[model samples]
Target: MPFRTSGPAASRASLPSRAAGRLARTTWVDLVVAAAVLVLLYLTLRVGQGTTVRFSTSQSAKVDTDPARLPYDAARSLLRMFVALAASVVFTFVYAYTAARSRRLERILIPALDILQSVPVLGFLTVAVSGFIALFPGSMLGLECASIFAIFTSQAWNMTFGFYYSLTAMPRELDELSRSLRFTRWMRFWKVELPSGAISLVWNGMMSFGGGWFFLVASEAISVNNKDYALPGVGSYAGAAIADGDLGKVGWAILTMAVMVIGVNFLFWRPLTAWAEKFKNEQSEATEVQRSYVLDLLRRSHWPRLLGYVLRPVGRGLGRAARILGTDDRPLTHDPARQRTGDIAFAVVAGGLILWGLAGLAEYLHDTSGLGVFGEPLLLGLATLGRVLLLVAAATVVWVPIGVRIGFSPKLTRIAQPVIQVLASFPANFLFPLAVWFFLRTGLSIDVGGILLMALGAQWYILFNTIAGAMSIPTDLREAMDDLGVHGWQRWRRLILPGIFPSYVTGGITASGGAWNASIVAEVVTFGGTTLTATGLGAYIAQATAGGDFPRLIAGVAVMSLYVVALNRLLWRRLYRLAETRYTL
Candidate 1:
């Protein structure tokens, strides 16, 4: 009636203007996000209620692998992962903050973290499950607590490392600027340090989440002391499928997991990456910025502002707590005597903790076994160590080049992001059958195949960290490299390696630890009742776990922890210092 355009050309020309005019900035997206979030909370709460229900041993062995239950099971498993993630974040912030602020603590905490990272989830599961079950007798909540803790151990260590690196490696210029501004420690932490490390935190948090997923089966389908504590989840569903030789159910689990992973990536991480772009400390805008529709919609909506208003009192409370805790009186004092006293006190406390732990461990070993308690496990650890080192080396050779290339091209990264995430998140157990098949078909030994399986589980750590490292290299520097005609090996030698070295150290350390843990899963493989065992510490640990042999599990875990700590202290620790001190941007 108003002579509106109806022809194809006119309609096409008017579409954008009409769409823009018709779009309500806050209405639709706000409603959608609110609805989705509320629904999710409801679902999580509904699933969590099952945690307090009565439990029985027979229930664990009778996981119904029906495809119909896959969605509910997936939701339950996802809830566990999220709860563990929340705990891991809390641990990372507190632990890394303490260690970063205290030199003495750093010296102790870093090595302790290395040892903790090397302790396999099964090791924790074996001990934690019994204690938790005793604490909450005849209830599913205890098993839930044990499972969440297992997932937390898998996630917390590398995240702490990332945050610690972030805090410890702030640019000199930023530190000086904060000094010039006479910033309080809390203000500096809030304004400069946290923002600087936010990117690393997000990326490493992503990696940690994937690691949780990689070991989800172990966490969800647990067996301690020959009592099946397997909870109702996709993990138990899949494990039961594998045991029953039902490839079809396994396929369903895979599909369900894929959908869940993809949904989370698109809805959560992609948006976070786009939001994090504002925190980048570059001289020029990135050549290609990350974009996510969810982020865009949120930015255009009024909900964030509304929510901030509603949460103001909570924010103030947190701010007051931060002010009290983050206050450092040390900087105001030039008294060397006071500093020395503090140092002495710190050392005494740390030494006492170490001694107490060692005494208990020694006593336990004494009580558990007679002779050569740790000797065979130590030797087996060396075998596993050989596999870890070799596989890490190989993964570096393969993934570094690929990761660098991917990182350099934002478009390629955008296209490949989900693919890489899925690949990393796919649990190693799913692929065990393939490895077992290869071994059966080719007559290759598990000793060699074990390395491959470990690489499969652990290599993503290297790749993801390398990609972050490459992306963080200043765009201005790359342009200068181009202007100076830097090409090929020289480009990599001069710009790439130095730029990525610090990140590579972080990645390599985490990757090696992941390989150490993966050995427990990889060294022992089963596909449809056909089992293969490799001669390594991982197999020793796995066998002990299956048989519910507590003393043997502890022995294997302790030796593995010692080997990992020694390797980190001797090799990776030195490399870490070199990179942090010499190769920073």
Candidate 2:
């Protein structure tokens, strides 16, 4: 040894060299992360300035289509989506928890959510705009809130269903344990219910985010009561480009949206998805864990460590505050008589509201064009239903096998998951020009082309859920199959199909709803001065909205809602029950 360094003086002398060595060892990841941070900071500053200047006056104006302003516009759009997603999460927890925990509440809440889910994207925007404007009068913030709420409607319902399903499906043993421990409501939610439901919530949240993107154009480019309102965003950019027949701007907007979607998948979804796997109730024999380099970097980073150290006291103080505010653990006693009376009252009120709504709808339609007008809408509904069923069948046949193959392989899943997710989140309308062009060029029927477009937006639901189901299959079951030499169609029919049936049903329900929603945008495509309208319910609703025919719009939406709810109750619900009884792991 040259010289022993043991004293404080020696340690102090080594610090500079150690720091230099560590800095030298930094990889390209660090540089990339640094660049990203700087870019984000610049964008934030630019967007902040733009917001103040743009919203200074109360007048609503058209969004600019300048390529240079695209970044700021995209930032604003993303901010709205993020805000809406946050609100959806809060709503999902409260709404789903209530529905799951109380039988009395569940009777009312579940059907309410079902009807809400069936409500069209434009319906939400049409109903919400005036209320939101009144709430935040004389400010751009009001329109912003309305836009966010529209996106929220697209996102919230499925997430609520996911959480509620997870909660109700919790293992009996876990429920008994919580009750035996006399856990406080907060404790039960935080420690038991939340964790148990978290994986489902995350998956549904991803799907909801994708659904929001599908409706982004409608939400941002608000057209209600025959008046068009445009916000500065990629959605508005695309809408304006389509209206002007500017293919160049449309191309640019598409590219920008793709980049943003990829960035979001990597930065947020990848890490969250990896983290959520840990919350799954069943253990697998697979040794390899889902990995996220971003998450790993943050966990090991020096800055995060220092920040944690600084905030340690604050965290402790908050913990103390939480304990002080915590509620008692005692279980509440139920009165059967009171519960019965409450149920009866709720039923009466609900029945009255339904009858009143039907009367109003009938009156409005009669005043406008009479009940004879219902013929066209009912025919459109049947056409759309045929397309939905056909597309769903096609998707199931194609994706189920592919999804299972990928899900069963860790290496493949690691590679393909993010790509599939980003693709799913891509707004289907971005391809409208290409689709319209193809149909126009090839002389194909617009009806066929429209159904394909609808399928593109909806099929990912089945794919992703199939993957989730396959991944959840126990290793022991797989091993047992292998040992028994079960293979080919026999193995699939006996094991794999049954295992994924529940997930497939969940996905199918959502996919069917999404297909219906997508019809609004996909059924009618306009590009480069060419317009194509497919004959269906989507076109019907789109026409009504465009013409400000409120009665027709409401009627079309109601018919669509009825179809969706009826299918859920008659078909999917039965399948779900079968899955629970026979296939649940």
Candidate 3:
């Protein structure tokens, strides 16, 4: 500051031995988590492969089936899903940065994001299949590559939202500290934002995977209007068995899905939970410690050996380079004459849109596919719009009070969070057959089945996020409200409602997108080959996929996407802005 305090700053900056001790304690926890996960994985593989691990389901017309080879299938699916997940992490960071801090760019980003999310995964399959085939003609691997990209769409959006919320809601002091340091963009992102957002993003990732699994059957097993392509996967296998009413394979699918979910939770989630705990600023002194596996592994490993190697000449050289380049904790300064660029650079984005549009058009026009039979764009648009509204209303009405109640009560919040997490993780497709059975037995309209399927994923988005928002309300504000004798409707209107408004908006945004996904199953049902189809965009796209009409598929997707974009821009954006100004500080 005023006095040159640099001589003492180095001493002040150094961490004490106790910090090292605490770190070591955390490392031990990580190793234990890692070992448990590894053991579980090995056992699941063995059981899934073993001759003794056999089960049957009603889907196979009550016939018994063997699960001896499911280990191979599960392993393969898990590997691919993990790769897609990693890619999702990268996409989320980019999305979060643009959405949270960029003023003008956020305006464009939020709507564009809404559209991107609203377009169903099935729609991506329709567009991607033709593109991949063209990208690598006569290559079987090309088709598989296309399939994985479809999966990416399902996983990325929720992750993006998680990062967006974390960055936007970062503590004010942290914000000032970042600004004062004049940290480079990369440094700020890596050192500050990433840690803050990681826990929420990880949870969102888990939820996204659950959402993705709902579409797995349709994604892994490809079909467009009788031109069917079944890629070798548990999804394809499950789809095949389901189509033929192979109940035994259904049992195998259920078992495999359960094992994977539990295994993932134990391995990936446990360590992340531990690391995330470090980010919390305590309201009270240390009470209880949560367990972590990765921390354990980090401790027990040959860290000393690694550190010794790193402390040598080459490592010292690298460290010096890092310091010189302002890659360490130093501030970076650009020349005053060189002005900083505005966010996202709108001109660049416009150019990108043009290029993307051209590529899409070029692909569609060259194919010479008969896309006309898929029906009118106006009809598709109206159908999708109706479904979106219906689903949002349903989710809103159900989750609002539930979320508010959970938020205001700490004990209730803790209990509800885990329940919601489990429900969110359960794939919606698990309820599909049950939905169909109930509807049929009750003589309910086929449309109700579609709504139920859509609600399955969309409802959780609102419920869970609402609870999160509620639980996060500052203790002081709650106390002030209580002291004022606020209760019932007045309490909700002034305190609870305003407190959770931002989260409610986010939940609505996510729920609407989920509705689109739910439509894939909801609008197009194939119960015993007597398809009960809804009159909507989803049905139109489904028909195109079944018919191999790529052009019509693109048209349907485009129309639906445009509608989504328009609604988000005109309606949701206004609501989001209101939330930001009125509720968020």
Best by TM-score: 1
Worst lDDT 10-window in candidate 2: 49-58
lDDT-superior candidate, 2 or 3: 2
Higher lDDT: candidate 1 or 3?
1
- Rank ordering of all candidates by TM-score, starting from the highest: 1, 2, 3
Tens-digit lDDT string for candidate 3 (1-585):
464445656544433443455446655555565576698688656533432222221112121134675666667566557767888888888777877766556766766777789777877787687787777666555566666787788888877876787787676677678768875555567678787666556557766776766677777777754556655566766766667666667777777877776667666765565555565433533334345555566546545444554455464465455456553222234443332243336657776987998787866656665445334876666866787898898778888898778655645643554456556655555555555567778988766567776776677778766765665565657677778988889988887888778767767777777877677677876544545677777777777767876677777777777777777678776777787567763
Question: In model 1, how large is the Cα lDDT of residue 422?
Answer: 92
* Pairs of residues clashing in candidate 1: none
Model 3 scores what on Cα lDDT? Answer: 0.66
Give one digit per residue, the lDDT tens place, for model 2 in 401-436: 998997678778778876886678777677878887
Superposed model 1: Cα runs more than 4 Å off: 1-26, 57-60, 179-184, 329-333
* Cα-based lDDT at residue 519, candidate 2: 86
The CA-based lDDT of model 1 is what? Answer: 0.84
Q: Counting only residues 3 or more apart in sequence or on different chains, how many pairs clash (N, Cα, C under 3 Å) in candidate 3?
A: 26
Best prediction by lDDT: 1
Clashes of 1: 0
Please give, for residues 312-399, the per-residue lDDT of candidate 1 as tens digits.
5565676677667654533534688877898899889989988999888888778878446788898888899899999889989999
